[model samples]
Target: MNCRGRVSPGTAAPTEERSCSWLNPWVFFVSALVIKTAFVTVCLVVFLHGSDGQYKTLLQNATEWRCIPSMSAGKKESWTCCPKGWKRFQKSCYYLPADKMSWAESEQNCTGMGSHLAVITSEAEQEFLYNLAKGAATNAYETKYYIGLSASGNGQWQWVDQTPYEKAATFWKPGEPNLLFAEKCAAIHIKGKTDSNTYSNWNNILCFTSCYRICEQAVKVV
Candidate 1:
């Protein structure tokens, strides 16, 4: 007997099977496109965030926190901020101790503390020390401070570390170093009258004279 639609055994399925098969490729293609788009979006977001973080780190390292970029309009972009209890100028740290000691004693104390007496190598450094001395003198009984300069018995002026002191680089007051024959040490007059020169004048004095001291050490950023 003829079974018609019921007699499907060993026979290929009709339109429904073909229709479902045709839709599978389109569904898989759409699904794969959506997954690829999501993956790309995630990668782009991560890349952008990493780039921004690196830029900010660069800015921070460049200034050692002394300055940073500003996001606000009309805001200052650079500023100066020193570490606590230490003065920051350029890349050095300075400490002006109020305790009075002899030139040799001051040097010893500084070395004991991992520093040395202020060594003026540039005019900018001199200016900084001079200004600091001026301020310190206001609170000091005698306005003088021992620096790292002295002369040998042979009249050769030298830094405490034995470097030659340039005569042209001297900041002595007029008619100063007058007692060079007897005075072997150098000191800066923080608050004194110089008829024809600037303040913070240098003078040759006895090495044992007691005065305030300035300590200088390098700043390390980590």
Candidate 2:
């Protein structure tokens, strides 16, 4: 009998298995490497996507917080944001400091904050300022607020930024500016509840009068 064609002592495996057994180590190693590479690639992709989503979410929140609500004719519009504790309206930010100051002192205070006393350009701005003054008053007593208008230079009503104040475009009281001889600075009179009709009108007051200041700063483009 031929011993090679039959099962021999301690050699019971088939011929095909015995011939391909030597390649087992290489196949196992290659398969493990491929599995590890695929796992690492999937993890990296997931991590990157998560990080990008989180960043975008944070950016969107920041942008939304920066936008402020501006009111006009009961309609709201988005505008640049204001600093902390300041109010936003149209293209400007206004701050009413609680400390009372004379006209010059108020101007200096505003300059220290990189701003100037409030400048009213249109009726909308004037009304907005009036509302701010009313809120700041917070009592039944009338409160006066100093603005940026002054007639100190040659008796001409002028803004701190040298914008000429047009009499025809002003919101002064009916007989206001009559004391152009002595009163040089301008103020907004916030009347009490009983005198609401006379509230928020521009008045020519003494330069040394102590009053709250309305600071104005232009909103920066985002």
Candidate 3:
């Protein structure tokens, strides 16, 4: 309608109303973005405050635990260092002796020291160790690593911590355990030569048959 109360003549009212409808969608979008940003900001503030003391404690503990949503039942769990002389990694701890021992002998030594040969669990754990061994050893390229608990005895392999075997998670070089007449302990694949990748396969080579071992223990996280 005209300001003078005369009936309006312009026919643009319908177009203006149609254009205004788009405003609602844009408003909704902007509102959602603001809400999300606020939520993230709040979370960051809380975490920064809450985690301030955590990193220091974890450093002392020499271990860490990351919550695996898929592997998690509800909340995250904790794992700490089993002892001194052990390298702490995420959730678990490891030991690479100053002097090497035969795999079986290594197992017994680790047991005596309240630990066992390392057990490979998650791919993260695998990579953690793969990198670890590579960094610490001059011969990582050619050295085979030992893990605790092999299918060695009774065809029943168990973690030193006695965690489930989790058969589905075992990463073995194919044709392995050929059980080859009871040469039963497990060893990481290694080649006598260097290559771009740590070959996760074997080539007629077997356990060091000499010594050098890595051990592990579950931190009795109280």
Question: In the order shown, what is each candidate's alpha-carbon RMSD?
Answer: 13.2, 12.7, 18.2
- Per-residue lDDT of 1-222 in model 1, one digit per residue for the tens? 222334378987564422235567788999999999999999877865674354333234333333323343786453344335667777677778878999999999977766678777777778788877776666434477788887888887888666567877778877888777788888877544322234438888888888888877665432
Model 3 RMSD vs true structure: 18.2
Q: How well does candidate 1 match the true structure in TM-score terms?
A: 0.58
Across 65-144, the per-residue lDDT of candidate 2 in tens digits comes to 24554555866443456567778887888999998999999999999876899988788888888888777786647788
lDDT of 3 at 82: 45
Better of 1 and 2 by lDDT: 2
lDDT agreement of model 2 with the native = 0.78
Show model 2 residue runs off by greater than 4 Å: 1-79, 198-200
Name the top lDDT candidate.
2
Per-residue alpha-carbon lDDT of model 3 for 28-112, expressed as tens digits?
9999999999999998777656744444433444334433222336856643434655777766677777676667787888887
Considering lDDT, which of the candidate structures 1 and 3 is the better prediction for this target?
1
lDDT of each: 0.70, 0.78, 0.60
Cα-based lDDT at residue 10, candidate 2: 97
Give each model a TM-score: 0.58, 0.63, 0.52
Question: Which parts of model 3 are misplaced by more than 4 Å?
Answer: 1-84, 152-156, 192-208, 220-222
TM-score of 3: 0.52
